[model samples]
Target chain A: MRIFFYSVQSEWLKTKNSIASWLCLVGGFFIPLLYLIADIKNKTFINSAGTEIWQTHFTRLWMNMSGFLLPMGLILASSLITQVEFKNNSWKQVHVTPQKYSTIFFAKLAVLLGMTLKFFLFFNIGVIIAGTVPCLIFDHSFPKENIPWLYFIEKNARYFIACLPIIALQYLLSLQFKNFVIAVGVGLAGLIGTFIAFRWQYIYLSPFSYTNPFAERSGFSENILLYATIYFVVFTIISFYLYVNKKIKG
Target chain B: MEYCVQTTDLAYTFSNRQQVLDNVSIHVPEQCIYGFLGPNGAGKTTTLKLILGLLRNHQGTIKIFNKPIAGHRVEIMRSVGSLIESPSVYGHLSAKDNLRIFQKVYQCPQGRIDEVLSMTGLANTGTKKAAQFSLGMKQRLGIAIALLHHPALLILDEPTNGLDPNGMVEIREFLKLLNREHGTTILISSHLLTEIDRLATHIGLINKGRILFEGTAEQLKKEKNRETYILYKTSDNQAAAALFARQNIKPALLPDTIKIAATSKENVAGLNRLLVHNGLDVYEITTEKNDLETIFMNLITD
Candidate 1:
């Protein structure tokens, strides 16, 4: 337990020095700011298109950022965390220490998860700031009736929960490849491939499609969750296994 | 006498079908500086990894402080500090903070952080991030981390690979202090023969994954003297040759010099005086002793 906390703290210190964290936070804010400007210019036309248009637009933006942008951020963060060890030749140093494999593994995992949460915070802050400008300029009543605070929380919660599996996948891929570009490339391919596969009528079978926060389902069916759950568990197991059993060869 | 580390018939082969270590055995005595000497691709690093339990699927048993390393890995690891190749420092953290993290990992006293920092000469660099450190400073920080827990043994692989002469001296002195004061047994690997010759009490010379020689520095020096040669420069080289012939020395003459094998240092002076007394102007007499380079060359050639 002490070692675990130490690993997490050390990883957190490393995360603060990373460029990916800054890029994700800044990029997330920039994208929402552009969307707000477009919304303000077409406010009159958008209001005439009814409340469903606003819902669809908001949902689509949130889904696109959560499913694509957020995962990309984590992919970069995960790659940086793992690649630092390889580039600096620190794995051999750490492996011979008293710290156990599980401690180091989870410490890195905590950093990845923490980075993901920070991205969400930055995304929501951007949304709130962007929403404020239109709310005052267009004399909009804040859309409280159509989009309740509880609904906002529910949507964000689901988006965050759905990211857990991707986080695990990215961690595994990053640990497997000591190169940043290769890990990020494989992550981008997996994200784009799954997104394209979900466009077919067999979307129910696709794990990426289930990432839809607004989908009208209480709980996932055993089959759909099984696909993701199996992958999540397997990747996590293999990541830890390889880490513990890996030979320290330069 | 307790053995800090012992390996029996250890072997490892990489996935690319390259045999890195073949039937290598090492014995590191407690409170001694055991130098692992080898050329590049000689499996020095591979042997260290196998002893540290970093690599599995080996053919032999490794016992650290007399306990098998397989089941008691964590217990054994806690009492060992290692700098395998480079310092495993988080470049972003301050030098002090890096030590603090390892302090927590090993659950050692906080005061040891300062102790190790001062030991490594990083005490004045407090609050300075490790990223700004030079390669030698980074190596010191690595040694600091290894010393944090006050382990019974410290393992270092090529610890002086990239240091300047001053930095090398600092690390060498620091290791000596650790061994003399703290009684920390050390197992260090290096390809530099002179450095190992100066610091090591016992050496294991490895070549092609096999230990070519394992003994004390004195023993190696003795082995070197057995193959010593005497170079004699004389005015009457032919007369000196006849003198050696009369004495049944069988000297080989080349130009103005005669070469003769001498088993002891006393024999070189004896032969020089004999040549000078025999109507020969002995200008110079030099004895060439075998060194690591010669030993390594002989091992490889044979």
Candidate 2:
């Protein structure tokens, strides 16, 4: 366990100087900033009374990402994580270490899962700043009373946790294949597939549809979250098993 | 013999049904330079990877430091440093960062990073990422990473593949120094026998996925030197050749000397006595040593 955390810290360092990582960070700030600028410019946002504006904008924010961008974004971020090792030929470097493959595997998976949650936190902060611009600029008051901190955390954290299976799937793809386009291409195809299966009663059966439950409604769906959690557990097990047992070919 | 690494009846087939390694058994003794000499696709790197636990599906046993590699991999690998095939590094990272990655993994002291950087002669490469590094620099960085933890054993596959002659010589000298000063057991592999010929105390030759030979370099030289040839220079080269032909042994007469094929030093001495008794002056009888390249070529062909 000590080695596990240390490996996790080392895994995080891979992204320190990466431009792709910086781009992903900028995305967290950019998405909400774009949405807020558009929302604040609209007359309907100005005419709306009280928490309705926050609710509508927040719903739109999660929906836009949860529908396509967040799923694809999670795919991109996960691919980037494995990309560093794959493109750099660092797999052999890591494997020759005293640390077990299981430790290294979990450390990377945890970091990607952590990044998924991080974007959520930053996205919410972005939303908060941009969402409240009108309240402060036009209404001469902060939207503190209007912003649901608990609700924001609850929803963002829920959606983030719900996206685990996707992250795991991406990690598996990236591990299995060397090229980033194939992983991201498969993910984009899955994102498009989610649109077709999203309204189905059993949407959570698909890993990509986990975010839909959070985005389509105000609260979490017990059945879909339950299903996503089960998938997360299964994906984690299967991916780790394959990673440990599979031969690393040069 | 106390062996640092031993593989018994190991064989492997790829997913595409290409069998890369076939019943290969190689033993590397402790505290010596073991050369894994093989042609391309001769399973040298595959064998190294098996010892490192990078490839798990194989048919036999790999014992490293007296422990079965499958069972005590992490513990066994803790004392091993390896550079398999090409240098494994994050090209996006600076040289220091690459060393730092392994240093953190091995949990070595923080200051050891600088020691390795200076040792590999990359201490002055500030903020220069590995991607921008020259091939030789990357190779040195790989060695630095392998040397970071100060492992008792170092397994390097084709360590001098991309190096210039001077770079190769420097690395050879550096490895010799490491082995001499620190008593580090080095297992290095290469397709070129000359590369290993200069450094290897012990050698294992592989071809077509099987180890053709494994022994000390001197042992190989002794086996290679089995056939003795003496170049006999004489006052009368033709007279010496005719004298040897009288005994039904043909001697190829050159301009100033006659080449005689004899089994042993005693045979050459007897021939010298016989030629001198036949009114011929034996100026010099130089014994020919079979070069390693010839022996290596013969082994591969056989």
Candidate 3:
């Protein structure tokens, strides 16, 4: 436990100057801000379905982010974290420490997990802040009374859970390759694959589509979580194995 | 001598089936500087990485501080420090922050951050990111990170590589200080004979993934003597030759010189005085210098 804390702390030090972390945070803010501006523009031009604008807007926000930006952001975040190690040639340095190689791997894994969680935080909170502002500025209903808090939490939970396969796959890819482009390339390719899978009505089967808002009806499907968990477990095992066993070139 | 590091019949081959390290064994004595000398691609860095547990799959045995490295690596590495090849620097982090990363991993004292910075001459590099650091500065920071925990053994692979002359000297002096004051056993590798000559108390000359020679510098010098020749330039080359013959010393006579065997220092000095006594005008006496370069070449070629 002590080593784990120290490891995270140490990993944090490695990233203090990295631009990737800031980009993830900015991505969180950027998504909502875009949604807010569009919401304002839409309210001004079109008047209709006045029952619950917040739901439509919130769902839109979730769709774009969970579907496209969040997964992409997670991939970039994992790449950035590993980039600090490989780009700097710190792999040999970190592995040489007295700590166990497995311990070191898990330590890095923890930091990546923290990054994933942090991304989710920014995305979720940005939605609220961005969602609330339009209501205040345009005199639209806040939708606070009808907002299902449990459902909201469940939706975010399901989205995070469903995003597991992608988080694991990208994290594993990032750890395996020293060249940043390969991981990023694989991720971008995976993003495209998700869209193609969407038309086949099997997008939920694709880890990339779990957080995809277009596939929201199937987001909480048991098979989606089960598949996500399976990929998460499998890829995570492969990542740990590679990290602990692969002969790192100095 | 107490060996701080020991490896026996150690070998490694890459996935491509190219042998990176042959059957190799190296013993680094406690508190002594063991220079691992080899040319580029000779597997010096690979060997060090194996010893440091940066890579695991290998054939044979490696023991650190008398403990087998296979299972006891974590415990053994607690007393070991290493810097392999290029300096490991996060270009975005400051020198202080870079040190902090290692300091935290080793669970070193909080004050170690400042202490290592000052020690490595990076104390004033406040918030200056490592990307802005020169190669020399980056190397120093690497050394500082390695030294922060004050390990009993330090394995450095060409630590002074790419440093200016002054920077190299500073690092050489620093390693000497570490050995002298802190009783740190050092195993440093370099292809530069001059650099190793300056700091190494013991040398393991490796070529093509095998140690060609391993011993003290004096032993290498003795190896040097066998192939050395003494050359003498004189006014009376024929007279010097005749005189050398008379004294039962063979002389190779050239147009302007008489070259005699200088098998030993005492013998050379005695022969010079004898030639002077024999009325041979010995204008110049020169002995061939069999320095490390010649010896290293001989070892590799042979």
Top candidate by TM-score: 3
Can you write out model 1's per-residue Cα lDDT over A125-229, one digit (the tens) per residue? 776666556777877765443544565676666666666667787788778777778878877887777666654555554444445432334234334455556
- Best first by TM-score, ranked: 3, 2, 1
Native contacts retained by model 3, as a fraction?
Answer: 0.87
Give the best candidate by DockQ.
3
Off by over 4 Å in 2: A39-49, A132-140, A144-146, A213-222, B228-289
Model 3 / residue B272 / CA error / Å: 13
* Model 1 chain B lDDT-worst window of ten: B293-302
Which candidate would rank higher by TM-score, 1 or 3?
Answer: 3
Model 1 scores a C-alpha lDDT of 0.77
Per-residue lDDT tens digits of candidate 3, residues B59-121? 978989988888887788778888899999889988888888888889889798898788778
Candidate 1 residues B1-302, lDDT tens each?
A: 67899999998998788888888888889999999998888999889988888788889889999999988888899899898877788787788888876776777888998888888888899778898999899988998888888888999999987789988998998888889998999999999888888899989999899988888888977887677778788998888888988987988897878888864667777777887777788898877548866776666555
Identify the runs in model 3 with alpha carbons over 4 angstroms from their true place: A39-56, A135-149, A201-203, A218-222, B231-286
What DockQ class does candidate 2 belong to?
A: medium
Going through the candidates in order, their DockQ values are: 0.52, 0.53, 0.66
Interface RMSD of 1: 2.4
Interface RMSD of each: 2.4, 1.6, 1.4
Model number with the top lDDT: 2
Please estimate how well model 3 matches the true structure, expressed as its whole-model Cα lDDT: 0.81
